[model samples]
Target: MNQWLLYGVLALLPLAALSGFLMGRKHRKGKQDNRLSSDYIKGLNYLLNEQPDKAVDTFIDLLKVDTDTVETHLALGNLFRKRGEVDRSIRLHQNLIARPQLSSRDRNSALFQLGLDYNAVGMYDRSEKLFKELLSDPVHKNESLVQLLNIHQLTRDWDDATKIAEELQSSLGVEQSKPIAHFYCELAAQKRQDGDIKAALSNVKKALTINPDSVRASLLQGDIHLQQKSYKQAIKSYQRILQQDIAFLPEALPNIAEAYSNIKDNSGYRSFLNKSLDAGAGVSVLVELSKIIQAEKDDRAAAELIGNFLKERPSLKGLQRLITLHIEHAQDSAKPSLQLLDDIVEKLISKKPRYACHNCGFETKAIYWQCPSCKEWSSVKPIKGIEGE
Candidate 1:
């Protein structure tokens, strides 16, 4: 019922007719011509009867997959798949593959298309098996490996993904370090969830070795150390994010503060917060630095810091914190009004997404190392603007 499918069927009608004509010419036999003509007429009747599926089936059956007609069959099947007719595409490719006269190359092509058909419908196990069978294929080897990587990513089989990525890079000269690092980070996260800190650290180390600029790896490494109460080591790991990618400094600020707190080093925490603020960290850094100032000095001093910041870079988060500071120091009559303003800002910030995909514009409240919409590695980062870091 899709308009694209309708268009595709209409386009294929002529190709089917052309294929039949060409095959008839190639054969130059009266009986073969009569068979092709009869089948073509039958297909036209199905179309006239308003059964497009039947028409399509009949025409594709008439244009059998052979040297002369294989490309037409492939084009039709791929078009069906692109038009969201996966079932029809699968059937066409299956029929093409079943033909005994198809060349090895064409058969591989059909198999790959069939695998894609299965993948489109979320039948990943079947697609995985088909793609794996094509690993040694000359034409489809790299592509199959790429598909296999996708399947493993969907299945959360990080180990298999790592192997396939390594093979893709080593054999094909593909640059896969970024994804390879993320794969190790995934494995580390799984291990960390299972409470295997040693294995988690090992995987994080591998991730860092693969990509020293991996902010996710550094965050994971810092978390593992913090969990073990190795506060100094955790601080070291968390600070590494600044050198790796300063855009992620906001993510590390709170944890770094917690680490310094565990070691009872407020001065060092304040110094680190100031350094991060100087390095263009987000509003979170400013908020933490204000908290430190409020503890050491006074509410008015902290308010001044945030008020100065808001002048330079306006942020809802900064404004929210500034309102909180004003509420603390305001007269009782003004407190309710400031509190109401604070609640509005808080609610607005809560409704806004904290992270978004760089590859696609998919936004979410939580961070995803791989984008949920685009399924790209490390594409999701903290959103930047008034409502976010």
Candidate 2:
């Protein structure tokens, strides 16, 4: 649960306690002043005197575990945890679990809540142990697996995360293929960084097997092959991405063109660029094609093509390209002014984010398969607009 939701629960705790007290008013009160024990009064006094530690202890002692008060206590414990009072939540939940009169269901609930409290406090080992213990209970099996998966992800324990996610999928029928693929891709990336190319490829293959259309897997496969100087194989792997998602064509285009250049396949690269542009890929295709025109044809031809493209769809990147082409071809008398314009455009383009999260609107210069802000897979993509595309 998010801190905001916990704040609401905390706000409602007093009301929940009041309601519970009112509902259980006639039950074993024995005229004990609405069940506010002497210890509770003492705890309130300690709190008023600014002795929080003593107050917390006295309050815990004053809490009488009963059927009617269970929800109230749980709400308050959760509230404290959300308010960053994790120690209090821990003590409350722990004390509630230690009660011999608690029903089996309430006991399990307390355990789960306590696990969440531990997680909130960065006691991951304790949280993981509690969640693992919950796997035997059908009531919290899915939730426990999910929390364990979260903990493994936070620790970058991709192997453990994959195993827990697989169990979650099989046991709870939750959709996990996307994250599972990402986990394999993460493993592949780690192996690649460790200079274990073969192991990296093995993990990439596993990612594709789990999610055949995973763009990140294909990109990683192409990248590794390119790094190994397998230019033709790399081009083939990158070309396969067109069948998956066209939004990522720009991601593979530059690498594929570079691989083709290594193999002296300029015509093939140019031809593929034309095909992709004709299929309405993005401004990246237009920019690459314009570069080819400037090199093989002339600056005027390239400028004309880009100017016409801009007329149809004005883009910050395309305008920058146009300005750069002008600066390259300008006469000596006009060179300084055109170069200044190009610098301004470059600065503008650099300041604008190239990628953004569709889920959370988080913008950044680089691409991410999962949104860092929202932790959602396939939600961050290349920004599409006049400034980005």
Candidate 3:
């Protein structure tokens, strides 16, 4: 709800009560002498003028904190949280929690809200305990479990996260395969980094079993295979990523090429890139193919390949690479001009973003499986266009 509208409603509550109180006095005593606080009067005027921003704070300050004003207090605390004033929200909810007279429902509501406040401020341990406490109440259980999952994820407590995800799936009937798969993948990455290859591959297999389309799981499996010099398995794993999501095909290119070359199968790599290009992967595929052509054929052949691809896609990176190749092999008389153009294109390509979030339009120089700003999973992908691939 709009803050102003919420404030406007809060402003009306006291006014409505006061107005009824005055009318009762008039009916009983027949006088126009009923009094209200000056702040209350000013706040009512502000609300009448649609300036509830000024009215809400002024009115809530003058109102006594009691059962009568609990709703207003909660609304104000929510507003504070929305505005990122987490400390203020925490204090308000804590005060509400301390009120012995509060009903059971209201107390639980305040406790749940305070848990969120703690979560917002990076007190994951506190929030985790608080959410665990709320898990017995059906009203707060699902949301608290979700919050606990987020906290576990933030803390990299994969064991705890896996347990909660499975429980949520069974008890709450919530589908958790994606998150469960990611949790296993996270475990795989950690184990792989620790050189526990057996455990890492085991986790990778579990992730893939849970979510067959998990690109991260496939990528991890491919990386593990490549590290083990299992070229055929690595190539198969990398190829699976293209089937899972072609948007991430670029991420697999370098590893796939290396695996092919490790096995003396450059032609296979070349064939894969061409097939991917025919299916519309992007400029990275073209660039890699051109590099392969240059290695196998000549500078002129590579340049012509890039030239044709750029003619269709018109990428600054592709153009820059083409110019770099020319400058590398250009005649001495023409080197300086080509060098200037290459430098210009290089700067332009450097300034361009290489990845963007499909959900939020957040741009970045590098790919991210989870968007930093939006916290969305698998939303940031390698950008596709002339300037990106």
lDDT: which candidate is best?
A: 1
Overall local distance difference test of candidate 3: 0.83
Any idea what lDDT model 2 has? 0.85
Q: What TM-score would candidate 3 get against the native?
A: 0.79
Ranking by TM-score: 1, 2, 3
Candidate 2 residue spans exceeding 4 A from truth: 1-37, 47-56, 331-334
Top TM-score: which candidate number?
A: 1
Better lDDT candidate (1, 3): 1
Tens-digit per-residue lDDT, 1-389, candidate 1: 57766775576678567756876775785456667777788877776665778888877777756787888888888888998998999999999899898899999999999999999999999999999999879899989999999999889999999999999999799889999999999999999999888999999999999999999999999989998999999999999887887778887777887899899999999898888889888889999989889988999999999999989889999999999988977999999999999999999999999988989899999888888898888888887777777
TM-score of each: 0.91, 0.88, 0.79
Candidate 1: regions farther than 4 A off:
1-12, 23-31
Give lDDT per model, in order.
0.88, 0.85, 0.83
Model 1 TM-score (2 dp): 0.91
